[model samples]
Target: MDHAPALVVCLTTVSDEKQAEALARTLLQERVAACVQVDAPIRSFYCWDGKDCVDRELRLVIKTTRERATALQQTILRCHPYDQPQVVILDCSGADPGYAHWVGENTTED
Candidate 1:
Protein backbone atom coordinates (compact mmCIF):
# COMPACT_ATOMS: atom_id res chain seq x y z
CA MET A 1 0.00 0.00 0.00
CA ASP A 2 1.11 3.50 -0.80
CA HIS A 3 0.07 6.80 0.74
CA ALA A 4 0.47 10.14 -0.99
CA PRO A 5 0.43 12.25 2.12
CA ALA A 6 -1.53 15.41 1.20
CA LEU A 7 -1.35 15.09 -2.56
CA VAL A 8 -4.34 16.31 -4.57
CA VAL A 9 -5.43 16.76 -8.15
CA CYS A 10 -7.52 19.78 -9.11
CA LEU A 11 -9.66 20.27 -12.21
CA THR A 12 -10.81 23.49 -13.84
CA THR A 13 -11.91 24.64 -17.28
CA VAL A 14 -11.42 27.86 -19.18
CA SER A 15 -13.05 29.42 -22.25
CA ASP A 16 -9.83 29.57 -24.24
CA GLU A 17 -6.25 28.52 -24.50
CA LYS A 18 -4.97 31.95 -23.40
CA GLN A 19 -6.95 31.75 -20.19
CA ALA A 20 -5.72 28.22 -19.66
CA GLU A 21 -2.14 29.32 -20.07
CA ALA A 22 -2.62 32.26 -17.73
CA LEU A 23 -4.11 30.15 -14.98
CA ALA A 24 -1.45 27.45 -15.28
CA ARG A 25 1.37 29.97 -15.26
CA THR A 26 0.00 31.84 -12.25
CA LEU A 27 -0.34 28.69 -10.16
CA LEU A 28 3.20 27.59 -10.97
CA GLN A 29 4.63 31.07 -10.44
CA GLU A 30 3.04 31.33 -7.00
CA ARG A 31 4.26 27.85 -6.01
CA VAL A 32 0.71 26.71 -5.38
CA ALA A 33 0.93 23.93 -7.97
CA ALA A 34 3.74 21.62 -9.05
CA CYS A 35 2.37 21.14 -12.54
CA VAL A 36 -0.66 22.26 -14.54
CA GLN A 37 -1.43 20.32 -17.69
CA VAL A 38 -3.69 22.06 -20.19
CA ASP A 39 -5.82 19.54 -21.96
CA ALA A 40 -7.39 19.90 -25.37
CA PRO A 41 -10.77 21.56 -25.66
CA ILE A 42 -13.65 19.52 -24.37
CA ARG A 43 -17.31 19.99 -25.09
CA SER A 44 -19.09 20.87 -21.86
CA PHE A 45 -22.81 20.58 -21.37
CA TYR A 46 -24.39 22.16 -18.31
CA CYS A 47 -26.91 24.60 -16.94
CA TRP A 48 -25.75 28.05 -15.94
CA ASP A 49 -28.16 30.34 -14.11
CA GLY A 50 -31.45 29.29 -15.74
CA LYS A 51 -30.31 28.37 -19.22
CA ASP A 52 -28.88 25.24 -20.73
CA CYS A 53 -25.54 25.73 -22.38
CA VAL A 54 -22.86 23.86 -24.27
CA ASP A 55 -19.32 25.03 -24.74
CA ARG A 56 -15.90 24.00 -25.92
CA GLU A 57 -13.52 24.58 -23.08
CA LEU A 58 -9.96 23.75 -22.20
CA ARG A 59 -9.42 21.75 -19.02
CA LEU A 60 -6.52 22.24 -16.66
CA VAL A 61 -5.20 19.39 -14.54
CA ILE A 62 -3.45 20.84 -11.50
CA LYS A 63 -1.18 18.85 -9.25
CA THR A 64 -0.34 19.97 -5.72
CA THR A 65 -0.72 19.11 -2.06
CA ARG A 66 -3.53 19.67 0.46
CA GLU A 67 -1.25 22.18 2.20
CA ARG A 68 -1.52 24.41 -0.86
CA ALA A 69 -5.20 23.82 -1.59
CA THR A 70 -6.46 27.11 -0.22
CA ALA A 71 -3.90 29.15 -2.10
CA LEU A 72 -4.65 27.15 -5.24
CA GLN A 73 -8.39 27.82 -5.06
CA GLN A 74 -7.91 31.48 -4.21
CA THR A 75 -5.53 31.98 -7.07
CA ILE A 76 -7.95 30.35 -9.48
CA LEU A 77 -10.84 32.51 -8.37
CA ARG A 78 -8.70 35.61 -8.58
CA CYS A 79 -7.52 34.81 -12.09
CA HIS A 80 -10.37 32.93 -13.71
CA PRO A 81 -12.55 34.82 -16.18
CA TYR A 82 -15.78 32.92 -15.64
CA ASP A 83 -18.58 34.30 -13.50
CA GLN A 84 -18.50 30.98 -11.67
CA PRO A 85 -15.29 29.20 -12.36
CA GLN A 86 -14.93 25.49 -11.69
CA VAL A 87 -12.35 24.65 -9.01
CA VAL A 88 -12.59 21.03 -8.05
CA ILE A 89 -10.03 19.12 -5.95
CA LEU A 90 -9.75 15.41 -5.32
CA ASP A 91 -7.54 13.63 -2.80
CA CYS A 92 -4.92 11.39 -4.42
CA SER A 93 -3.80 9.34 -1.45
CA GLY A 94 -3.62 6.21 -3.60
CA ALA A 95 -1.11 7.54 -6.08
CA ASP A 96 2.47 6.42 -6.60
CA PRO A 97 4.64 7.70 -3.75
CA GLY A 98 7.51 8.89 -5.91
CA TYR A 99 5.28 10.97 -8.20
CA ALA A 100 3.39 12.38 -5.25
CA HIS A 101 6.67 13.32 -3.58
CA TRP A 102 7.73 15.17 -6.70
CA VAL A 103 4.53 17.19 -6.69
CA GLY A 104 4.98 18.15 -3.03
CA GLU A 105 8.60 19.09 -3.52
CA ASN A 106 7.94 21.42 -6.45
CA THR A 107 5.00 23.16 -4.81
CA THR A 108 6.78 24.12 -1.60
CA GLU A 109 8.61 27.38 -1.18
CA ASP A 110 12.39 27.32 -1.19
Candidate 2:
Protein backbone atom coordinates (compact mmCIF):
# COMPACT_ATOMS: atom_id res chain seq x y z
CA MET A 1 0.00 0.00 0.00
CA ASP A 2 1.15 3.47 -0.82
CA HIS A 3 -0.04 6.64 0.82
CA ALA A 4 0.98 9.95 -0.70
CA PRO A 5 0.05 13.51 0.15
CA ALA A 6 -2.99 14.81 -1.66
CA LEU A 7 -2.72 17.03 -4.73
CA VAL A 8 -4.88 20.09 -5.18
CA VAL A 9 -6.52 20.49 -8.58
CA CYS A 10 -7.83 23.99 -9.15
CA LEU A 11 -9.89 25.24 -12.09
CA THR A 12 -10.52 28.83 -13.15
CA THR A 13 -11.57 30.47 -16.40
CA VAL A 14 -10.03 33.59 -17.87
CA SER A 15 -11.01 35.91 -20.71
CA ASP A 16 -8.18 35.12 -23.12
CA GLU A 17 -4.96 33.30 -23.85
CA LYS A 18 -2.96 36.28 -22.64
CA GLN A 19 -4.71 36.23 -19.28
CA ALA A 20 -4.37 32.48 -18.99
CA GLU A 21 -0.71 32.54 -19.87
CA ALA A 22 -0.07 35.38 -17.44
CA LEU A 23 -1.72 33.48 -14.61
CA ALA A 24 0.16 30.29 -15.43
CA ARG A 25 3.50 32.04 -15.70
CA THR A 26 3.02 33.82 -12.40
CA LEU A 27 2.02 30.65 -10.57
CA LEU A 28 4.94 28.67 -12.01
CA GLN A 29 7.37 31.50 -11.40
CA GLU A 30 6.34 31.67 -7.75
CA ARG A 31 6.37 27.85 -7.54
CA VAL A 32 2.82 27.96 -6.33
CA ALA A 33 1.92 25.37 -8.95
CA ALA A 34 3.88 22.53 -10.49
CA CYS A 35 2.05 22.88 -13.78
CA VAL A 36 -0.89 24.71 -15.33
CA GLN A 37 -2.85 23.56 -18.39
CA VAL A 38 -4.80 26.15 -20.29
CA ASP A 39 -7.79 25.48 -22.50
CA ALA A 40 -8.77 28.54 -24.44
CA PRO A 41 -11.85 29.73 -26.29
CA ILE A 42 -14.28 27.91 -24.07
CA ARG A 43 -17.91 28.93 -23.84
CA SER A 44 -19.15 29.69 -20.37
CA PHE A 45 -22.55 30.62 -18.98
CA TYR A 46 -23.28 31.66 -15.45
CA CYS A 47 -25.26 33.99 -13.23
CA TRP A 48 -23.92 37.38 -12.29
CA ASP A 49 -25.65 40.12 -10.38
CA GLY A 50 -28.95 38.32 -10.82
CA LYS A 51 -28.41 38.19 -14.56
CA ASP A 52 -27.35 35.41 -16.84
CA CYS A 53 -24.18 35.98 -18.81
CA VAL A 54 -22.42 34.04 -21.51
CA ASP A 55 -18.86 34.49 -22.68
CA ARG A 56 -15.87 32.84 -24.26
CA GLU A 57 -13.12 32.07 -21.81
CA LEU A 58 -9.96 30.12 -21.21
CA ARG A 59 -9.81 27.49 -18.51
CA LEU A 60 -6.76 26.97 -16.35
CA VAL A 61 -6.09 23.75 -14.49
CA ILE A 62 -3.48 24.20 -11.81
CA LYS A 63 -1.75 21.39 -9.97
CA THR A 64 -0.32 21.86 -6.50
CA THR A 65 -0.10 20.21 -3.12
CA ARG A 66 -2.92 20.34 -0.61
CA GLU A 67 -0.68 22.29 1.72
CA ARG A 68 -0.32 25.00 -0.91
CA ALA A 69 -4.00 25.15 -1.85
CA THR A 70 -4.86 28.06 0.43
CA ALA A 71 -1.93 30.12 -0.69
CA LEU A 72 -2.54 29.36 -4.36
CA GLN A 73 -6.19 30.31 -4.06
CA GLN A 74 -5.27 33.54 -2.31
CA THR A 75 -2.80 34.43 -5.04
CA ILE A 76 -5.33 33.76 -7.76
CA LEU A 77 -7.96 35.82 -5.99
CA ARG A 78 -5.61 38.73 -5.56
CA CYS A 79 -4.42 38.64 -9.16
CA HIS A 80 -7.66 37.70 -10.88
CA PRO A 81 -9.45 40.43 -12.79
CA TYR A 82 -13.01 39.35 -12.15
CA ASP A 83 -14.93 40.68 -9.16
CA GLN A 84 -15.86 37.07 -8.39
CA PRO A 85 -13.26 34.74 -9.83
CA GLN A 86 -14.31 31.16 -10.40
CA VAL A 87 -11.74 29.26 -8.41
CA VAL A 88 -12.55 25.69 -7.55
CA ILE A 89 -10.26 23.18 -5.91
CA LEU A 90 -10.55 19.42 -6.14
CA ASP A 91 -8.60 16.79 -4.23
CA CYS A 92 -6.63 14.18 -6.16
CA SER A 93 -6.63 10.99 -4.17
CA GLY A 94 -3.98 9.14 -6.14
CA ALA A 95 -1.74 9.65 -9.14
CA ASP A 96 0.94 7.80 -11.02
CA PRO A 97 3.95 7.43 -8.73
CA GLY A 98 6.42 8.95 -11.19
CA TYR A 99 4.17 11.87 -12.07
CA ALA A 100 3.42 12.52 -8.42
CA HIS A 101 7.12 12.56 -7.67
CA TRP A 102 7.70 15.01 -10.50
CA VAL A 103 4.96 17.28 -9.18
CA GLY A 104 6.46 17.22 -5.70
CA GLU A 105 9.89 17.97 -7.03
CA ASN A 106 8.76 20.94 -9.09
CA THR A 107 6.58 22.61 -6.48
CA THR A 108 7.76 24.89 -3.71
CA GLU A 109 8.72 23.50 -0.33
CA ASP A 110 5.68 22.87 1.83
Per-residue CA lDDT of model 1 for 2-98, tens digit only, reads 5655788999999998999888999999999999999988999999988999999999999999999989999999988998999999987677788
Candidate 1: the clashing residue pairs are: none
- lDDT for every model? 0.90, 0.86
Q: Using lDDT, give the best candidate's number.
A: 1
lDDT of 2 by residue, 70-91 (tens): 8899889988888889999998
Q: What is the alpha-carbon lDDT for the whole of candidate 2?
A: 0.86
Instruction: Specify the poorest-scoring 10-residue window by lDDT in model 2.
Output: 101-110
Q: List the residue pairs that clash in candidate 2.
A: none
